[model samples]
Target: MAQNTDGGNPFAEPGELDNPFQDPAVIQHRPSPQYATLDVYNPFETREPPSAYEPPAPAPLPPPSAPSQSSRKLSPTEPKNYGSYSSQASAAAATAELLKKQEELNRKAEELDRRERELQHAALGGKATRQNNWPPLPSFCPVQPCFFQDISMEIPQEFQKTVSTMYYLWMCSTLALLLNFLACLASFCVETNNGTGFGLSILWIILFTPCSFVCWYRPMYKAFRSDSSFNFFVFFFIFFAQDVLFVLQAIGIPGWGFSGWISALVVLRTNTAVAVIMLLVALLFTGIAVLGIVMLKRIHSLYRRTGASFQKAQQEFAAGVFSNPAVRTAAANAATGAAENAFRAP
Candidate 1:
């Protein structure tokens, strides 16, 4: 019995060899896949001291109790335990699936953000989201339809009088050129003491006349019709050119010569009265233009309500032109110059 005990174990107390079949009373235990041990304690347990205890005479061991069941070794028939391993593998697979879905969600969110930014940049309708903000344009325009269309294709408002004025100016310039040519013919046909005036008028026709067609009037037509920045710049340049030519004529009027400036003096020759008449016509044109701008203010509120640029709003209006009350009114007014009273016309 004494030899059967694990005497080397520090947790085994002395004199435990008598109960060789019983396990040692343990004080601590370790429950882990990597280790095996169990500990136990009993406060009520008492040990008899050697002096108080008497040794019992040894009884012959009953010929070992029938072979103990615990002595049998385990056989391969025992059920195999794969439950824990399979569960751990299933958990890992589920985590991988969850991560994949999370990544897919993140990618979709990024795509949405990209599209939103693009939409924000292209404020297609001259209308912006904010009251104070100018309509923001896309970096690049895809206006293929309007690329080569008529200059007046998309005007939201009318300036027919202004357009007509430009035409009249062009006609007058052409008539003046023809008159100068006839004057030359007349000087050659009849007896003129000094042909110098005819020659000077011819010079005026040559220098200042083509300008109305090629520079000033054409550019003005383009600017007003297109309402484009590039055309506006062209118009301004031509205006400055004409202004300079007129200024030089005003200064150099004394010398009657065939210079670009001298044709301007031809206006003075047409009679100071003709010059005054031209001035009044020009002033009337200016006043009508200013009045148009004032009217535009009332129209501006409608534009605010529409929240669209000229081209975009015009396209929409033309497509469903009269569906909106404001657009219907505008279209009617634009057809005739009398916008405020067009509906009341007899």
Candidate 2:
């Protein structure tokens, strides 16, 4: 056995030192820092007694039982199930929640319905329903079909029938004029006279119908409706001129109507039947001219009662023509073009 030079482990045997894989129980325990078990040093004081560290009191022992039962772990806040039969308290709470939701939905539905009805009323433009008390319009119009709605606003209640009668007479006049055109055509074919009169008469009828309605009837309607001095004067001026033209057409002057004076003379020279027909046609034209004069006079008298004058008509005409947006725009463009052309000139 060899002695160690440095202080050696007293418990370690010479054979054990050679064999480190040997069981450690054979070696004596040493108080070295590398292999020490450290105790925690807490600065704070604890309420637990020294006995508490002596090992927890053996967990309360279960009571002796003949048979064992299974136990379930439960959370403190977990809700208990009522199985098939729900508790009355829970049922009442759920019903209250459902009722609140249903009431909210009902209120919303009522608000939506009210808004829908208001929208419908506004969209209909105040006239919510039809008022069909008045008599219906005639089935057919001889000259041109007139929309009752167009004139209904303008015409007075008492004078509505008078206006209707005037329209009927106008239709008759249109028919008479058409007949005169046909007569002129027949006379030209028979006598071989120049067709200038026939052509002019056709032109006159074609131009006059729409022009007369626009110039006379419209102004007359407006005058009566508004009791406007300007409108009445315009109606009177146009209508008087229209009546004069009618009288001239009825006269059958040299270049007027082929079927008028010339046709009458030729027919008188030839066949009695033809002459009678031509005379009747000429008489119809004369009657229409006379009717026009009478209607003009009647309307003029009514206008005079309203105190309309030529001065007011001139002012209205000037305002209507100059104040129009289209007229202003046209005038502006013309001025611009004229200026540009003058600037460009050599």
How well does each candidate superpose onto the true structure, as a TM-score? 0.28, 0.49
Give one digit per residue, the lDDT tens place, for model 2 in 77-125.
9765545365767797899999999988886676566556546756787
**Whole-model lDDT per candidate:** 0.48, 0.66
TM-score of 2: 0.49
Report the lDDT tens digits of candidate 1 across residue range 41-123: 33575644325446798988766566655575556997544468889799889999999999888866765665454466456
- Off-target runs (Cα >4 Å) in candidate 2 are 1-149, 261-263, 318-323, 327-346
Query: Which candidate's TM-score is highest?
Result: 2
Tell me the lDDT of candidate 1. 0.48
For model 2, name the residue pairs that clash. none
Would you list the clashing residue pairs of candidate 1? 26-40, 126-309, 317-321
